[model samples]
Target chain A: MLPMFSGKLCQCLSVTRFPSILFLGVIYVAYVLVGGLIFWKLEGCSCITNKYSLLAITVLKMIKAASLSGLSPDSNDTADGFWKFTSSSVFAATVVTTIGYGNIIPLTTAGQIFCVLFALFGIPLNVVILNRVGKYMLAIERNFSLKMMWWVLTFLYFVVPMLLFKEYEGWSYAEAIYYCFITLSTIGFGDYVADHNPAINYPEWYSCLMAAWIFFGLAWLALLINHSIDLLESVNAYMRRRKNAQTQV
Target chain B: MLPMFSGKLCQCLSVTRFPSILFLGVIYVAYVLVGGLIFWKLEGCSCITNKYSLLAITVLKMIKAASLSGLSPDSNDTADGFWKFTSSSVFAATVVTTIGYGNIIPLTTAGQIFCVLFALFGIPLNVVILNRVGKYMLAIERNFSLKMMWWVLTFLYFVVPMLLFKEYEGWSYAEAIYYCFITLSTIGFGDYVADHNPAINYPEWYSCLMAAWIFFGLAWLALLINHSIDLLESVNAYMRRRKNAQTQV
Candidate 1:
C-alpha cells in the first residue's frame, strides 16, 4: 500500500504538480518585476497623495494583523464553557476550509500574513479532509440506508445553522438557506458579510467570530456535498450491479 | 419530450435560476444603497481631494469603456489579416483561457466591458458545458486509451502554450504554464497582468484587449477544471459499477 501510494504520488508530482509549481514561480517573479516597475512609474504620477499613502499603509497593516492572528492556532481550547463549541468537528472543518467571512480576519500584519498562508495551505488540507469524510459517508451508506443517513447528517449539520441564521440574523428562512448554500459553496458574493452590525462595536473581535463561524459552516457543507456525490456513485453502482445480475440470470 | 424538457426547465428555474436572479437583484439594490451612503460619507471626509476624485473618475471611466468595448460583438468578426494566425480554434481556446502572455486584448472601453461581462457569464456557462463534455469523454474511454486521451488533451491545451509563453515572453516554460493555469483558474493573483508592447501601443484599446483576453481565458480554464471533475465522477461511477457487480456475483 505504501509503495502504491508513493508511486501514485510520484506520478502526480512528475506529471502535474512539479510543472505547475515551476510555471507559477516564473509567472510570479515576472509579475512582481512588472508590477514593481508599474508602481515605480505611478509613484511619480502625482496621484500618490498622503491620504492614499495612509490608506495603503492601513490596508497593509490590516493584512499583516490578519496573517499573524491566523498562524497562532485558535486559543479556544483553554476555555471551558461556550468555548467547547470551538473544539467540535464542525469548527475544525471550518478552520480547515477557510470560508473566513471577514467577520474574523487577523488583527496584526503577521497574523494576516499567516491567515493568507493558512488559507493557501487550508485549501489542499480541506480536500484531504473531504476525502476522509467521503470514506465515512460511504461507510454510513453501507451500514444503513443512504437517504436516511444523508438526511440525518444534513439536518444535524446544515438545517440547524440555517434555522439559527434565520432567527439570529432576522433573515427569511429561504434567505437563510440561501446564505448557507452560498457560504458553503465559497462563492462569497459578500452580500451578507458578518460583523457589520453597528451594534457590534468591537468590529475586530466580531469579525473574527463571524469568520470562524463561516469557516466551520462552509466545511460542513463541503463534507455534505462530498457525501452526496459518494451516495450518487453508490446508487449508480447498485443499479449497474442489478442490471448485470439480471443479464446473468 | 417537450413536456419533459419544460418540466426540467421549470424545476431548474425554481431551484437555481430564479433564486440566482432574485439574489442578484437584492444584492444590487443593497449595493447601490450601501455604496451611495459610503460615497456620500467619503465625499464629506476632509481627507479626500479633487485629484483623488478625478483619478477615481478616470478609473471608473476606463472600466466602463473596457466593458462597453468588450460587448461590441461585431468588432472581432471583421477579420484583420494581422491576427490570422491567432484566430484558430486552439488559439481561440487559448485566448479565452487567458494564457495571453501580453499577446492580445481589446483596445476600447466598450470592448473591455463586454469582455468583463463575457467572463462573468462564461464561467458559469462553461461549468454546464464541461459537464456535457465529461459525458462525451466517459463514452470515449477505453481503459489505457482514456489515460492517453487525458494526457493528450492536457498537452494540447496546456503544454503547448507553456512552450510558446516561454519562447515568446521570455518566461521559463514552467512559469508560462503556471501563468496559464493561474490565469485560467481566475485566481488573478494580479501578479502578471498584460502590458502594451510597442506594436500594440494604443493605450485604451490595449487595456480593453487585455481585459477581454483575461476574462475569456479564465473562463476556459474554469471549464477545463469542471471537465476534469466530471471525468473523476465518471471514473468513480465506473469503479462503483465494477464493485457492485463483483459483490452481486
Candidate 2:
C-alpha cells in the first residue's frame, strides 16, 4: 500500500525519517518475505538439502524413499563432477559474466580462495572483452542492414544453438531458447545446464568454444540494448523540449 | 594466446572468418578453462557436496565429520531455513540482479518455475528502477561536485555497511568490504554470507530490510559505473580523433 508520492508531501511533514525507514520495511515484507515463501513452498518438495530434518526416513530406506519421491534428490543430481571439462567450461562462463549460477561451485578451501582471485581478474577482463568485441561489432554494424544483422544474430546465437541443444540433450525448443537468453543476459538460474552429466562424453573442445560464443553473444545483446536506450533517451528529450515550447506559448 | 591485432588489416583480408572465431576460442581457453581449474583446486577441499564417493563415513557421521572439518559442510549449512526472512532476502536479491549465486537456490521443481517467472518480472522492474533512480541522481549530480558525490556514495553504501556488518556479525573489515563489493557488483560468489548462520538469532525483519538495501545499493553502483563508462568512452573518442588529425598533418 505505498502512496507512490512520498516525496516532499509527507504525512507528517516535520517527522519523515521514520516513515522512510517504515516504507522500506513495508517493501521488505510485501516483496521479499512473500516471494521467498512462495519459492519455499514450491521448491521445498524436491529439496534433498533438508535431509537432516527429515528424521522420518530411515537410512535403510533412504535411497528407495528418495527415488519414489522425485523431490528428494542429491545436490549432485546435475553436478558437473566438480571439475569435469565440459561443465567446468560452463562454470567459467558463469563466473566471468558475474552470473555465477553456482550450479557447480568451489568445494575446497583453495578453490574458494582461487575463485575470489580469479573472479577479481576475470570479471574486469570480461568487461574489457565485452567492450572490445562490442566496439568491433558496432563498427561493422553500419555496413549491414540492421534487420539483417538481427536476423543473423538471432539465428546464430538463438535458433541454431536451440536446435543443437534440442538434438544433443533432448530439451524442448522453448527450454533451449530460455537457456540461451538466461545465459546471455547473465541471469543464469542454473536449471537447464547442458552436458553437465558425468555419463555424457561432451567434447572438451566444444565446451572451450562454447565459452567464447557465450561472451560474444552477451556483448552483442548489450550493444543492441544500449543502442535502443540511446534512441529512447533522445526521443524523450525531443518530447520534453516540445512540451516546454508549448508551455511557453 | 589471442593476437589482438586482427583489426585494420582484416577489413581487406581474405577468409577473415578464422581470425574472428579463433580469437573467441582463445579467450575461452585462457580465460574460462584455466580460471575454472584454479578455482577447482583451490575450493575443492571443503566441498561437502561430493559425499557419494566418501562413502566410508556414514551419513550421520558424515554430517558430524564435515561439521568438524568446517570445510566439508552441507550446502544448506546456512540455508535460509527454507524461506527464513533474511536468507530469502538474500535469495531474492541474488535472482533479480542475475547474480544467481546458487549458494541458496530453490531445490523444488515449483520453486524453479516461480523463480523463472519472478525473474522475468523482477529483472525488467530492476532495470526500470535503476533507470528511474539514475535519472534523479544524474540531475542531482549536475549540481554537486563529482568527488563529493563519490565520497558520499562510498561512505553510505560501502563504509557504513562494512562497519555495521563487522559489528553485527563479527566479520573482519576486509570480509565486510569484500562481501559488499561482491554483492553490489553482482558477482555474488556466496562464499561469505552474512546471516546464513543458524546459530544466530537474527530477526526476520532485519533480513527483509537487508534485501531492499542490497537492491538499492546495486542500482546506485550501476548508475555510477554507467556514468564512468560514458565519460571514459568520450575521452577515448576525443583522443582517437586527435591522433587521426595528427596523422593527416
Candidate 3:
C-alpha cells in the first residue's frame, strides 16, 4: 500500500512540475544554450564589438578636433551628406514604421528630441493605416478565386527581392533571406542595411522600392501572424475535444 | 451658369483630391521633409557614417588578419567573450522580442539559419504568453480601487528606471527618456544600448533587470496602444454620429 501511494505521489509530482514557471525557465535556458552554442561555433567566440568600435570613434573624434583646429583639411570626399532627401525619407519611414535601424541615428540633442516626438505620433498613424490596409488584403486573399496563384505571388515577392539584394548589395542568398526575415520581423538590427554603401551610387528608385516593399510587407506579416494564431487556436480546440471524448469513454 | 458649374467642378476636385492617396502622400513627404530639415539643422548636414566606419572596420580586419598570420601578437586584452550565458539569453530574448540590436549578430551561416528558425517559433510563443499576461494586467488595472495610484505607479515605473540608467550608463535625463521611448516603442535603434561598456563592471543582476524591464514594459506598451486606438475609434464614432445628426437637422 505504501509503495502504491509513493508511486502515485511520484506520478503527481512529475506531471505538476513540468508545466509551470520552472519548466518554462528550464526551456528558456536550454533555448539560450543552444543559440549560444551555435553562435559560438559559427561566429567564433567573441565579445561585444563596442570596445573596438568605441576605440575607432574616439580616434575619429580626435581627428575631427584636429581638423577643426586647422591641423588637416577636412576629408569632404570620404564624408557624404547623411540627410539627403531619399535617405531622410528612409530614416523617417524607419521611425514611423518603428523599424529604427540605428544605422543613421540623430546625434544632436534637438534631433533626438524630434525623433521621440516623431515616433510618438508616427507610430500610431502607421499602425492604424496598416491595420486598415491589412484587413483589405486579408479579405482579398480570402476571396481570391485562384488562391494558389496568390500564394505563388507571395513566394515570388520574397524570391525576387532576394535576387535584387544579392545583385546590388553583394549578399549571398542566405544573407538576403536573413535580411528579409529580420526586416519583416521589425527587428531592424541595422547590421545588414541595404543601399548603405555610398560608393555604389544606387539609383534613386532603389531605396524607394525597398521602402515600399517593407511598408507593404509589414501589413502582410501582421496578417500572417493573425492567421497563425487562429490556426493554433483551432488545433488546440481540436485536441481538447479529443481529450474530452477520451475521458467520456 | 458656366461660372457656377466651374465653381462646383473646382469644389469637387478639391474634395476628391484631398481625401485619397495623394493627400496622404503629400503629408508623408512633408513629414519626411520636416524630419530631414530638423536633423540637418541639429546634426550639421552630413552623410552616413558608413564611410568612416567602413575604413575603421577594414583596418580592424587587417589587424585581425595579421594576428592570424602571426605578424603581430593578438590583442586579446581588449576582447571579451560575447556568448556568456547571460548575454546569450539576452540575445535570445532580443530575437524572440523582435528587437534585434545587431550589436552581436551571428556571423556564421548556420547560426543565422538557426536564428531565423528560433525567431519563427519563439516570437509566436512570446506573443501568446504576453497576450495572456497583458489581459491579466489590464483586468487588474480596471478593477483596482486606486486607479490614480496605479497611474502614478506607471509614471514612476518609467521615472525610476530612468534614474538607474542615468547613474549606470551616464546618460542625461533627456537621453534616458529618449531611450525609454525608443525601446518601449520597439524602435530599438540600438544606438544607445545600456550595459554595453565593457569597462564598467556591472552587477550580475544589471542586465537581467533591464531585460525584465523591457519584457514587462512591452506588454504595458501593447495595452497603451490598444487604449489609444479605442479612444481614437470612439472619437471617430462620435464625430460620425454628430455629422449624421447635422444632416438630419
Which predicted model would earn the best DockQ?
A: 3
Candidate 2: residue B168 lDDT (0-100): 73
Q: Candidate 1: deviation at residue B68, Å? A: 33
CA lDDT scores, all candidates in order: 0.41, 0.55, 0.61
Better of 1 and 3 by DockQ: 3
- Which 10-residue window in model 1 chain A sums to the lowest lDDT? A78-87
- Per-residue lDDT over A96-195 for candidate 1, one digit per residue giving the tens place of the 0 to 100 score: 3433222222223332233333334333434443443344445444455647866876675458766766655666655555455545554332234333
Off by over 4 Å in 3: A1-57, A61-80, A146-150, A234-249, B1-57, B61-80, B145-150, B236-249
| Winner of 2 and 3 under DockQ | 3
The better candidate by TM-score, 1 or 3, is 3
For model 1 the local lDDT of residue B149 reads 62
lDDT for model 2, on a 0 to 1 scale? 0.55
Candidate number with greatest lDDT: 3
What's the fnat for candidate 3, on a 0 to 1 scale?
A: 0.51
The prediction achieving the highest TM-score against the true structure is: 3
- Models 1 onward score TM values of 0.33, 0.55, 0.69
Clashing pairs in 3: A46-B82, A80-B47, A81-B46, A81-B47, A82-B46, A82-B47
User: Candidate 2, after superposition: displacement of residue B115 in Å?
Assistant: 4.7
